[model samples]
Target: MPPRNAARLYPLVLLLLAFVAFPLYWMASTSLKPQTEVFRVPPTFVPETWTLRHYVELFWLTDFGLLFVNSLKVCLVSTGLALVVGSLGAYALARFRVRGKEAYGRLVLLAYMFPGALLVIPLLLLFRQLGLTNSHLGLSLAYLTFAVPFVMWVMRDFFASVPVDLEEAALIDGASRLGALWDVVLPQAVPGLIATGIFAFLFAWNEYLFALILISDESLRTLPPGMMRFVSTTDTNWGLIMAASTLATLPMALAFGLIQRYLVTGLGAGGVKG
Candidate 1:
């Protein structure tokens, strides 16, 4: 609290920021470097010859544009689905007094206990039987197997933190239960929702296993798996890889930036029971 202590902390904070920011700075700098500069024995800290050739190539030469679209679509849809379904499930767990409620709650989380590698084969067979393989909707559903459980787990606490009297008041005002949730409760839980949505989005955006296994169609491959096309047995394009990685981070950055204030509040509230 003292001025001297605050001054000591500022340097530590800036040092921490620089440590965190270095990778981003390197990725961006490397992506902008020309091929000649990227592999130079003594690598330049900044690009000697700054260029957008990698990005230009990314859009014009490869299937990157489509991959970007596929990732965006799948992550968005999956996040929305997770939020809706998980919120309802969490609400039920929070509000309902039913037999096996604790068991069911644990079961929801048990889905996440196994590694995706263990489940991919059975999932493949199921997808084949249902003709869900290689479809965005199918992948969206696949993502929910993970995201929904997490959402339910986190949101249970958040929903529990919401006052039941608020919902009772809404009921007296002639609002349906869902109406009360939407009109009264969700507003108070915005921070949690936003935080949960971010986690769901990151899961879908960065997930590779299901995207690779469930989607055989080249056009349908999400970014993580799709970007591997840039690698070959003989060669790897560092610039191309860095460029893709840099671009891949944008949607998440924008999402966080837009909801920066909500993130800390939501994560704190949603993570802890009142």
Candidate 2:
């Protein structure tokens, strides 16, 4: 149940919700609108004649399916790589007696903060030299330059929030260090891992500049750059753009819906000390 004061916050909360959700609702509505109706003066709040023409064109006329597949491939691989490597790095930082661990943690955050613009030229040069340009694996690794550090930073706090006593107790029971981590520590970290993983996934899913610069081939493009195909030098396809955008939003929306129960608590704990 909401606290007494929360009742008074309802108006503000609803206002915020409308502020965020209206664009999404409008986008969906526009995607279903007939092209002629989309440009009508004053516009309709809801479509007069709903149709799937845009969505159909998105697949058959454009290679949105290929773009979607490319995005999914790189993102999933990069996210998995970041999670495994970052979790181990965070575990070491939080649990081991390493010197300057705090400084190292700060450095990770610093790397994450470096503007993508700064790395674009250097990474493009490096990947081209390494012949990683135009490859999904290269793109995935490029994503990692940011994704790994973010995962490490968040997971570090999460690992720190978990009580060391529990790991010690397992050790006292004769579990190996790795075994204790597997049996005890990881179970407690599930929510945090899932929350962090989702955040990392979002990063890769939406990143545009790197994908644009690194991959010159049309077939290799991810959604953000792929969306640009809808806009021509003379005209734009609003319906197809909106339809593609609306469809792109589904995976993230579904992911959040599935795990929102744990998201807040996990984030909160990761930000706090035990």
Candidate 3:
């Protein structure tokens, strides 16, 4: 607010930015460095011998492309399922008088707070029973454990914030409850849907433990665990790993940027409600 305070905060802001960005910078930088220099002492801040060999190896020699596709498939399908199921549940909670609604909502939140590692064993056993183990479907289903609750909570808040009068007017115009939601409420809730969908997508994209435990077939492995193919007890391919990490991060960064305008608008809208 004041020039003196602004000047004092600028340096601190820049320092925080560096702290957040340096790891990403290092990951990108290492991906470009020649293998011999990757582990060299006095680590090169910039690659002297920048090359695309690692990327070439990733696409041409490895199954990285397949892994990428697998990750994409899982993220899209799981996020879609989560959004569909969560939005419906959220709408019910927000719009109707359901008994024990608060208790049910709390349980959903608590389910999300449970550690993923603890769920893996029981999930594996459950999947085995259903013949879902080692399948993409199984992996996507496992992801729902966290994604659905998160989407439900967020969407519930957004749906609650929406004025009921809008949906009432739609209903008076010969619209059914579902029709009111589709025609009236959802249009206003677009920002929340985008934000929640993207969160679900990113969670599935970066998820490792469930993918690793649920899938043993190389073809089914997603990018996170698939990157481990580059490592062995003997040596690790740092360049390849860094390159893959950078590539994996790009789609997420791009998705966030695309929705950033709506996300900001949504945040501002949610800050104060009637």
Which numbered prediction scores highest in TM-score against the true structure? 2
Expressed as tens digits, the lDDT of each residue in 93-143 for candidate 1 is 988898998788878889888999998888889988999888999999999
Model 1 TM-score, 2 decimals = 0.95
Candidate 2 vs candidate 3, TM-score winner? 2
- Between prediction 1 and prediction 2, which has the larger lDDT? 1
Per-candidate local distance difference test: 0.92, 0.91, 0.90
What does each candidate score in C-alpha RMSD?
Answer: 1.6, 1.6, 1.8
Predictions ranked by lDDT, top down?
1, 2, 3
> How many collisions per candidate?
0, 0, 0
lDDT of 3 at 153: 80
Candidate 1 Cα deviation (angstroms), residue 258: 1.6
Instruction: Predict model 1's lDDT versus the native.
Output: 0.92
Give the Å error, residue 60, model 3: 1.6
What is the RMSD of candidate 2? 1.6
Off by over 4 Å in 2: 1-3
lDDT of 2 by residue, 104-195 (tens): 88888888668999998999899989999999999999998898888888888898888899999999999999898889888899888888
